[model samples]
Every structure is written in C-alpha cells, then in structure tokens.
Target: MVTLTSSTAAQRPDFAAIANWIKPNSKILDLGCGDGALLKYLQQKHRIFGFGVEIDDANVLGCLRNGINVIQSDLESGLSGFADNSFDYVILSQTLQAMKHTERIIREMLRVGREGIVSFPNFGHWKNRLQVIQGHMPVSDALPYHWYDTPNIHLCTLGDFENLCKQCDAKILERRVMKQDRPIRFLPNLRGKLAFYRFERQNKSPKSTQD
Candidate 1:
C-alpha cells in the first residue's frame, strides 16, 4: 500500500507525529509494520512497548534485527487471536488501501486496541485526478506502480475514508494531510499526497455485527 521511503536510520516524519500522539509506556500493535522502523522509533522516543504483525519473512527478520517484538501473521484474518483491548494503540500505516477487507480490518483494529492510527496515499490528489482525466494510471512517489501491477486493490479518497469511519461509529480524534511529510492545512484533498487518521470506537466494547 505504501512504500518505506528511508531506513530506520531516518525516521518517517508522519510516524513521528504518531509518536507524539501516544503517551509514554503505552502498549502498541503495529499492523503491517515494515522492518520495525516505527516500533523502534516509538520505543526510543516514547518509551513504549509493543509488537508488530508482519507477514513478510524478510521484514520479520528485519524486526528481529531491530530488537523489536513482532508476529508473522496475515492481516486479512483479522485480530481475533488477540484479546479485547490488548493494546493501547493499533496502527495500520499506509497499508489500509491495499487490504481487500478494509472495513473488517478497521473494526478488528478497534476491537484489539483502544485506538487506531492509519495513513494512506490520497487517491484524490490533484495529480491523480489529472491522470484520470488523461485516461491513464498516475505514477508518482505515493503511487509507484502500473495500473495492473499496483498492490493497492481498494484505493480511497480522504472523504471516502472519513465516511467509512462514520458508518462504523469510529470517532476520528485526529486527522492530518501531508505533502512531503509536512502537514497541509489548506485544500488538503488537492494538495496533500498522504492522509493520516487517528480514531477510536465510540464505545470500547465491540459492537454487534449484523453480517
């Protein structure tokens, strides 16, 4: 869904913003954590303890090298194995758009952790819109694949994601739009390339699912 720009040597600025959001010593669960960069950063900057769930073997090895606790598991199966509110925060950075069962994953994230943070490439960015007008898939830093080959199966715009959150009764505590890792305050849907959302369930107890 999202690409890792730099190494653990150079931390992601948006994730730094996430670090600021979490309180010190809280527990975390990072979904699709790549190479344990965020977990490493959170420990150093916030003194938090946490685990990551990654399916990639190389990434799991990378997490071990980073001295971070990680679990190798598929996210599509959801967080059923974890106890309710097992973590203080659940993070799904830049991986939300690639998931096939996006709604289920969101609900599961809320169920397993008290709060959830997610980041994704904004599909409604001006460049993507212009490329649609030109009748071709846009290739850029945020979206770096050809139409057929892109790992992103369920792309969504900023508005679309917020609407989904509302439908699920998730309260968005914080939202940010970033361009070049800097926050964009004006017309973010057009200017920003990345969208970040931090949310929690309206009720910590799991809501009954009709389907």
Candidate 2:
C-alpha cells in the first residue's frame, strides 16, 4: 500500500489541512479525484472507505493501481449513482472552477454526503491582480496556464465563492486561505494563493430527500 506521511502531506498542503477536518474511518466520496492520491492517502491514514469519481481514463487506471474503488464518470452528468447521505464527506479539490454546472454539483454533493469540502485557486490574489493590471492573465504555481489553454472557466475570489455557497444554501463551516502550506491571516483574499472551504447544506435534515 502507498503510504503518505505528514512530511509528504506538506507538499500538498490542502491534503493535510483537509485530513485534519475528517474523522478517522469516515466514508468519503472524492470527485475529480486525480489518480486517487488523496483517497489513497486518506484510506491509509484515516482508514476511510468509499469511492472516487474520475473522468480521465488514465486517472481511473491510476486509482485502480492505488487500490481505490473509483467510478469512471463525468462530474457534469451528476452523482445520481450514490444515494442521499451515503457518505460522511464529498470532496472536490481544485476542480470546482472547471466545472460547467458548479451550483448543481455542489447541491448534489451535499445531497449525497453529510458535509462537503472544496478547494480552489484564489483569483483575487494580489499577484493575479497585478498581472490583470498589466493586461495579461495571471500564471503562478497555483494556476499554471495561459489564457486560452486554462481549464479554469469560472475563476473566482473568496467573496465570489462564499456568495455562491449562500445561493446554493450551503453554510460555510470553516475556511482556510493560504499561500502553499502557510496560513495567511491578514488580507487573505488579497494575499492567499488558494482557498479551502468546509460546508454543509443549511436547514438539512437526516431524512430529507428534497434538494
């Protein structure tokens, strides 16, 4: 089995932070799970049981190699295969911006799991702003793509994401804005390169089926 320690988790800071939020032995559904690295790490460390959803053919094979149960499917098609509240957490990491139906996906995530976690690049970072002022798209370690080739179609700031969560009736439970592995306490929206959020549907009930 592939083992990930705290030191290696630091390389992907979000994974470490997210792991802190999850309880041991919890069921997790990871969407856009690239190579099942996170899920594999979680399983080895947290003893988590569940599946991953990945669209890419190579990624699905990677998940298999990593000993993860994965569903090969497009996220835009919706997560109808899973029943309501089937898992402890549903995670979408750094892939929310590329989603075509963002709100729908969030709603589905909440409907299928007790809580949801999302992470994305912060478009409001000062470096990105400076690049925009210079009439060129920002390209950094967090968002390493040129204007035309970027997969991120819905780049947004911290504020934009919070507002969208409100619209979707998802209550923000915790938020971490950071530069790589370090937390930015001051002016996070402006200085942070990435954003991580933990949330759940507001007014949700254990027996409720309506989304």
Model 1 — which ten-residue stretch has the worst lDDT?
A: 1-10
Model 2 pairs whose backbones collide: none
Clashing pairs in model 1, backbone N/Cα/C closer than 3 A: none
Runs of candidate 2 with Cα error greater than 4 angstroms are: 206-211
| Residue 110 in candidate 1, Cα distance off native in Å | 0.9
lDDT of 2 by residue, 1-211 (tens): 4556767687888888788889999999999998999998788778999699999999999899889999999999888888889999999999999999998898888889999999999999999999999999999999999999999899999999999999888999999998988999899999999999999989686333244
The TM-score obtained by model 2 is: 0.95
- Cα deviation of 202 in candidate 1 (Å)? 1.1
lDDT of candidate 1 over 137-197, digit per residue (tens):
8888899999989899988899999999987789999998988758898999989899999
TM-scores, each model vs. reference = 0.92, 0.95
Q: Among these predicted structures, which one has the highest TM-score? A: 2
